[model samples]
Target chain A: MLIFIGLGLNDEKDITQRGIEAAKKSEEIFVELYTSPMPNINIQRLEDTIGKKIRVLSREDLEEKSKTLLELARRCVVAILTPGDPMVATTHLALRLQAEQMGIKTRVIHGPSIVSAAPSFAGLHVYRFGPPTTIPHPSPSYRPTSFYNTITQNQARGLHTLLLLDVNHEKKCYMTIPQAIEQLLEIDKEKILENRILVGIARVGSNKPELR
Target chain B: MLIFIGLGLNDEKDITQRGIEAAKKSEEIFVELYTSPMPNINIQRLEDTIGKKIRVLSREDLEEKSKTLLELARRCVVAILTPGDPMVATTHLALRLQAEQMGIKTRVIHGPSIVSAAPSFAGLHVYRFGPPTTIPHPSPSYRPTSFYNTITQNQARGLHTLLLLDVNHEKKCYMTIPQAIEQLLEIDKEKILENRILVGIARVGSNKPELR
Candidate 1:
């Protein structure tokens, strides 16, 4: 059996009781956190809470070498923990699908996610928020303008756009709100957001997440 | 001070440790369930875990007479609990905004919401899901068909639509998946959804929610 659990946002305590129980029942517990950032997360605290050492998997470990991980699950109970809700990142979704295809039982233990908290704490009606988009770090070869296009489309439809800033896991840096705005402006030929009052929320799922 | 805590899907243990801590810190805890349904929720278990009685509020109490609830928050620490992630419904958003306007501090403790879990458990990519649309119960005066429009727009954008079935609080009946699909077919004039393989997810946040 393979159980995918979300560790919620921010710190170790953000995990739900259901998640903790699942982790306890698993013969192997694995955590792979490169997909998202929670600056205050303490890995040690999470290990203590689950009462076992969590095998920390790198992005390559999960994405490229997930076959080995699945092999473990095929034989015994295994849990894969991620930041935010599990499977929001397609890598986890791919793993879940692969597991099921291999005839392995899979379950998901839900946790707090920024998808809900962003609208909730920002006081924006959830229904008004359109499909969320991420402002990616543009390279000369991979400068995608789709995120900008998504914002303009949502604005045209009279909806609010939820912007998620990209993360640079290797450099241990997160894309800042200002940095995202600068990136957006570079590709915004229509100037749709130039005069719009866009709300920026930070530290979601934390005790004191703020909206600006 | 007022804290909006989400109890998550299914049962009391679905609440994160962060949520439970916030409940324990509050002088008064109130739960409003009319907005959504969790058929397996154990109220007594929730009370026992928090070591306090939870004041249950109806739609009338929360929507019509929230002033009394806000008044209490102005003087003491208060926590309002909800079925899904708090403030997904605009009612909780209104109350939180009111408390903030009254100079009372407000915080949110997000839980496992169907918004995230539905996509996760169903093997659907969260980013592909567009602005969620709800199938509202139609009264002769309130028979709105805008949900069909939202789904069509999402399909045009090459996006997946996340359909939230309506909760009829007075009748204590949640709009079933088949009922929602039947409602959709009734208004699908252009045959947009008639041939589409729509996925239905039920009992999300529960121990055993199924996807079809």
Candidate 2:
């Protein structure tokens, strides 16, 4: 069996008991933390809690068909853990599809995700929120405003948008709220529209998440 | 202090370890099962798992400014547990806002929600899901098709719509997939939209969640 365990938003303890149990039963366990940054994740602490050693998988490893992992899963129970909900990243979903196509059974140990947690913490109705968009780190050749378009459309419909901050794990940079605001403001000035109601949440799913 | 603990999707074990810890520290813990139905929920097993006595609350108790609950929260730590992630409903958000207005601190111990999980299980992108809408049981006095509108809009944008199956706890009626499909097909004929791809997930967050 192949199990996808979500480590949730914060540290090691954020994983559900069911997730832990699933991880404990796995012959091989892999963790990918690059998708979303868990500010308080401790490898040692997590290993201690789960009583199993977890090898970290890079984005490339997962994107390259996850051959070895799938092979292991086909032979024995294997688990792949990820930040927030395990299958949030497209690559993971693709991997699951591949595993299923290979006739390997897969299971998901659900975990707390910022996808739903953020709106709740902000005391906003989740249903009123439209499709979520992520603000990318704009380079000279690749500047995008689709995220801004989403916000504007949602605003017209009297809906809220969950604007995700871009995370570049390769650069070890997690986009700060101020950086996202600066980027959005730059887009606003470029588009000549000033209407914006943005809620900046920092370190959500932590014990003391700062929200403003 | 008031804390909202989510019981997650299927059963009591779906609640995270953090949520369990939060409940254990609470002076008073309340469970509101009317919002969403947890088919496998066993109050005895849940209470034993959390090691606390949980008092069940009616929908009215939570909707009516949460008078008694908030009163106790002001004096000591109190928790309100609900199926899936707490705060998905507007009433929970209102209650949290009211608690904050009354100078009571509030915290959310996030749980697994179908909002994100369903997309993952279906191998669909969570970000591609537009505004979610619930299909309600049509009554003689009220027959609404707003949910169909949501799906059509999402389909136009090449996005997916998370159609929530309505649960009228008072009537002990949970909308089955076939019932929702029949309802949607009726609306599809009325709206003249031939494009539709609906994925139904049952018993998610359980040991066995059937998806099709």
The per-model lDDT (C-alpha) reads 0.85, 0.85
In candidate 1, stretches whose alpha carbon ends up further than 4 angstroms from where it belongs are none
> Could you say which candidate leads in lDDT?
1
* DockQ for all candidate structures vs. native: 0.81, 0.77
Instruction: Supply the global lDDT for candidate 1.
Output: 0.85
Residues B1-212, candidate 1, lDDT per residue (tens digit)? 98989888887888898998889989999998888887777889999999999999999888889889989988999999998899788888888888888899888888878887787778887778778889898788988978888888889988888889888878987788788877888888898876688888887766677788
- i-RMSD of model 1 (Å, 1 decimal): 1.1
TM-score of chain B of each: 0.96, 0.95
lDDT of 2 by residue, B1-212 (tens): 99998888887778887888889888898999998888788889888988889999998898874788889999999999988778787778789889999999999888888888887777887778888889999888988989888877777777788889889999899899999988888777655455545678888888988988
What would the per-residue lDDT of candidate 1 be over residues A1-212, giving only the tens digit for each residue? 99999999888889998899889989999988898987788888888988988988998888888889999999999998999889788888898889999999998888888887787778787778778888888787999888878887888889888888989897887888888888877777877777789788888888677678
* True-vs-predicted CA distance for residue B75, candidate 1, Å: 1.4
Best by TM-score: 1
Clashing pairs in 2: none
